[model samples]
Target: MNAPTVPVLQVHQLTKSVQLEDEVLHILESVELTINPSESVAIVGPSGSGKSTLLSLLAGLDQPSSGSIELMGKPFHDLSEDGRAAARAGTVGFVFQNFQLLPALTALENVMLPLELQGARDAEAKARHFMDEVGLGHRLNHQPGRLSGGEQQRVAIARAFATQPALLFADEPTGNLDSANSQKVEDLLFKLNAEFGTTLVLVTHDRELAKRCQRTLVLDNGTLVEAAHASTGA
Candidate 1:
């Protein structure tokens, strides 16, 4: 008999709202979710459906108005902004829609930044390994300004995985790419994710990409629901 796996993320009664003049705008309401270790999950929804908001909250980038969020067994919703930052350090990785590379840094430097911040003595070596993993090893000397969008994004992916984070969150990772680049990045994303055995939670509008994950969660009416399968209609 095997022991039950501990969840990487747990949420309950999650809600977020803001005051708009005299009206209170509700972005999320009583959402419940759980993700086990090494699970690949995708959250998909239309624009303004709070998909990004939920991702932010889950990643500890923002706090919800009310709820409990346990990230990696820590009380994420209870932590202050700085506390959240400290908790995420070295434990979490992120990939944003816009490649958030420093313009002054070369591709290798960008990948090495996080490792250097964590005081990893062999930062350059680790960065090089991941850059090669993403097939961007040849572009290591190029700066973000010189690299193509696809190459820059591959650098971002390598940077995200360099620290070997236990969990990763990506928001619209392929949104800015063309169909061809999107496919390539998608393939690389899943390939490295599996190799590293990192738990993945991504927010994207691409249904095809979502289907590649183990589960697809749909954000509807300010809450989450499991996406129905079209093949079996289950």
Candidate 2:
């Protein structure tokens, strides 16, 4: 039989630090983690515990001060900015807490942007389909300012999925919403995950949302610890 495939993401001895005036502030220490393909995992921790830092590193949005990260069988540290961007274009999608949609662009335009960037010929049609999937069909022509927070987030989700990314990273995706809207977004997120088999890595404070994932990794002062199965609802 064939050997098991390597994980989609691997981090080894990752560390990060910054110089401040006269002292070096250590933000992360020897962080190590692995995320398999199509797996859903949550990173939960208090503010400033380096949860966002770890997510950025995993997504190739930022580099570690030491050690290495491998994604999709490529060494992340070895890739240049352009190369990393290309890699992400091919394999990763990110949903920000602020819904990062371009204010000037309509919802449909925002959702179509990535596909167009990738030179896909059917960008419009594909974007439309994903918008409908996220229950944003009626809001296609609306700009970010005109939509509700939940609607804006749904558009962001559609944009992220438009690329059919192998991995999805979400940073406090429901942070700005009320409970009802948060639940709605959460349901949509899992629905898309189930339908597309997209691996999920979420950084959140919501225990209920974290519980829905297959595994949860807790970060404390930048070091990682596996949470109990009960904590993860695994």
lDDT of 2 at 187: 87
Q: In candidate 2, what are the lDDT values of residues 97-143, reduced to their tens digit?
A: 99999999999999999999999999999999999999989999999
In model 2, how large is the Cα lDDT of residue 124? 99
Candidate 2: C-alpha RMSD after superposition? 1.6
lDDT of 1 by residue, 145-214 (tens): 9998888889999999999998999999999999999988889888887888898899999988888888
What C-alpha lDDT do the candidate models reach, one value each?
Answer: 0.91, 0.90
TM-score per candidate, in order? 0.96, 0.96
Pick by lDDT: which candidate is best? 1
RMSD, each candidate, Å?
2.4, 1.6
How many residue-pair clashes does candidate 1 contain?
0
The alpha-carbon deviation from the true structure for residue 212 of candidate 2, after best TM-score superposition, in angstroms, is: 0.8
- The TM-score of candidate 1 is 0.96
The number of residue pairs in model 2 that clash at the backbone is 0
